[model samples]
Target: MASNKNQHFVPRCYLKPFTIKGEGAAINVYNLDRRRLITNAPVKNQCSRDYFYGQDDQLEKAIQSLEQWYGSVISEIIEPGYKLQLEHQYTLKIFWLFQYLRTEGACRRSAEMFEDMIEPTGLDSDFSMSIKEAVQTAMRAFAENMEVVSDLKVCLVRNATSVPFLVSDDPAVLTNRWQLEDKRTRGGSLGLRDAGAILLLPLSPTIFCLGYDPDVYRVPSDSGWLTLRNATDVEALNEFQVLNCRANLFVGSLDYAEGLHRFVDEFIHHRPAARHIVNFAIFEGEETAEHKKYRVVSKSDFKDAHDGIMHAQTISQIPSQWPSFLLRRNKSCAYYNGTGIGYLRQMHAAMIETARPFFKVSPYK
Candidate 1:
């Protein structure tokens, strides 16, 4: 058979749990740009593009193989009385990392960062590459990244509200409640291995898997599940989808389209201001002055949340209005109950990718 041309960055299997009746064919989507709700959108084409990873099918096949495993894992996740297990924890964390990295949203943000980094330098257009090429290059390093985050602790979050959890074109969200809220580092990026680093992915409408740095947040998960009984907490979690998604958001049913619209309308302002932040600083070359060479010193990042989570704005003002479920360590390195600080100095993955572009022209030379 001809290599599949329509490649999906968000695998259909991963979205199945959020599809209408878990049928895997249809889903509900809220498009932020359009301010529109699309009921029963075709799951197959939702987050796909033609040959997204290139004409080479190897990456596609590789993703498919792991996706097959993820499908089985979801099957178990949906089973009644499913408790998070060591084997399942590993499976979910690995899959979570894969889902976080492989999405179209993730690759596009990186590709944009690549172009933006060189654009100010007037670099030749010939040096520019497409998102697909970026995806291919990143995939080459996927195994290495998987190694870095293998140690993240995993737990399941059960949503006990009438509002089901939401998924997005970029489903896996990496946030640091500890880093962002810290007055010392409110705008700092979250490191994967850093204290209070948290990763979340909605498994089905009712439950999502959470990974964290055990040294930071002390989730009381002896039963392997943290239940979100408060609707506000569920909404707070859903807002992360809004903050992290490229354009589209997914839920299990059209029944939620109306409420989801209202929910998004209320907090859509919280979405990251830009896709990637590239900060550039120019400094003194040396005593040689004009004769010496200098570095541009640009730092580009993803999952750029300098302002913290949407509810954080409200919660910060109200103090005790939300996020009751996030438990903090008595003496952890991170801070607060649960807050997404910034990007990764450690996990080194962010969804939107920030473009700081400081580009300081002054040199001490």
Candidate 2:
């Protein structure tokens, strides 16, 4: 862990409600870092001039309104099993609302006036409906034109303070951690370590760090933040690549499985000679009895199965013929799809590297 004494700045995600008591209520949508203004709106006031007098005022008001509504809606709808804590739900809702509002803007009609706008001709209840329709149409056009932004890759770098440590390498650790003991027990099959490897990968121009948990066959716990870099900083890139190359393990999440898969298929499919170790933590779809059955696959089994390759970590390992392998585990794979590609590429590299040395040399000569 980085020095807690120095206190790394964690971005704050919030939905701040702004109300002058009787004057009006609005919400300010803020990202975790509070760097960008998302949207704002007035709850009771409807006059365009009374609310959004200028672009700045309009934006601020819209952000405030969005934050207010998001907090209310999430608190009302989210269920216990969804794996979204109240705070995370707030972030997700803020992201969704920001996307929604950037295209549609604020509803022209008052909240109570919504009934008057709906009609049998499929017309919406307000002018905002038209705005939404137009946004959707534009989005479809962009998607067809291959202009939609699918992922946002971020790079995070932290000076290693202390090497990673694992508590136990006993088979009982896996059985207890994943509740797999009653089903299968392999003798002396557990491996624990005080220090593990960290791999870094470049997504666009940024580098992301990856690692493994030797105790549980799971994804490495991420450092929780990312650093933006200048694309031309070759020195920084070289340093990042060196740190990544020396990493002993690779960790990944199937937070955005589709995007991750696309990146992997594109990048790794052509690199036939690269040996990589990949691990994936799959999070989507409903779990079934089959997934519950074979949960005891050990780290060694994972290492052996992937031919000792590990990189990307997902809930389930994707079967492939790309001369790559995966270490699989189950976890809440929630992540923004915008950064999935870089993560997948890193995993691909790890898997390929893990399998490279074992390929039998041809004796044709």
Candidate 3:
């Protein structure tokens, strides 16, 4: 059973890429709340909990198997001048999906949602689920999310500037350009199948990756990879770690700690004090079962993040050089001739029904 007492939600192998020499023993950390940079923070004790996923050997085994494969793949990815491969992309995408769902921040967010649901039900009579339960439930849905992500196009980004990339406690953060532009709709959050959805994760200090809604955004690329030459783009991207990180922001090296700290200090205000913002509305003229009806929606409060205070609302707003494109709009009809798409949603059970089974490929290979 591997004595799985200390289980890492954010796999140690994953964080090693952003560590000193990819050593995994130590890394630099920027504590947002504490307003300080912690050099050489022990990687072992950073984002883990004892039995975080509960005392289940099968679950831990399944996670370790994927983590092992992911580590092997990371070696190939961080190699200098390594060409992007479909096999590698597919493998990396799965790793990102697992990382997105398997963090303490993710579990905490799920627990919040669960607790909030119970509060509304008024069945507050000791009905509860732990963060461990939330993580297990998230694991069960990994296959479903994988299918949802398959609709998006993937790309690799190579950082060309001296400003090194940074990571976070929750690395695989999801953002929707369309929704984030103007959050006027009742849609509380962005889903994998949602139009304009983008997933960003920093693989190494130099290599970055993203999966985006192909119909809405066009990332200017050569073949399958793009080089990030502008420091502004790097800064904008790094701000994501600041805005989305649960607590600690990690870097591979402290060489740019001063620069990174200055950038974070200027923009950390974009990160909200709370994880969610609740919006409520009351309607009086409803002719249904009651004269008065109440509607409330809780959304992840981020900087452009939140309903306001945006560092970069869209990718166009971020990168100055080698900019990404939001599909051109034909003023008469946006969605016509495959130009602009107002919104896209995928919910058919068959379209995303957990194909290929979970952990089908043996990690032993």
Tens-digit lDDT track of model 1 for 159-268: 87889999899988887776566665465555555546678888889988888776566777667888877889888778888888889998877777779889888888
Candidate 1 error regions (>4 Å): 285-322, 333-365
Name the candidate that leads on lDDT: 1
Give the TM-score of each candidate.
0.81, 0.18, 0.79
How big is the positional error of residue 80 in model 3, measured in Å on the Cα after superposition?
2.0
Weakest 10 consecutive residues, lDDT, candidate 1?
309-318
Model 1 RMSD in Å is 9.7
**Model 2, range 1-365, lDDT digits (tens) per residue?**
11111110000112111222212344222221222323333332211222121224443444455555545543432232223234443344233323322221222212112322222224444543443344334334433432111121211332221211110000001111221121221111221111111122221111222223332234322433322333223222222222212111111212223432333334332322222223322233446965432233334344333222223221111112210111333331211122212112222223333322322211111
Give the local distance difference test score of model 2.
0.25
TM-score, model 3 to reference: 0.79
Per-residue CA lDDT of model 3 for 78-133, tens digit only, reads: 88778888887788878888888889988887777667545543455468668888
TM-score, cand. 2 vs. native? 0.18
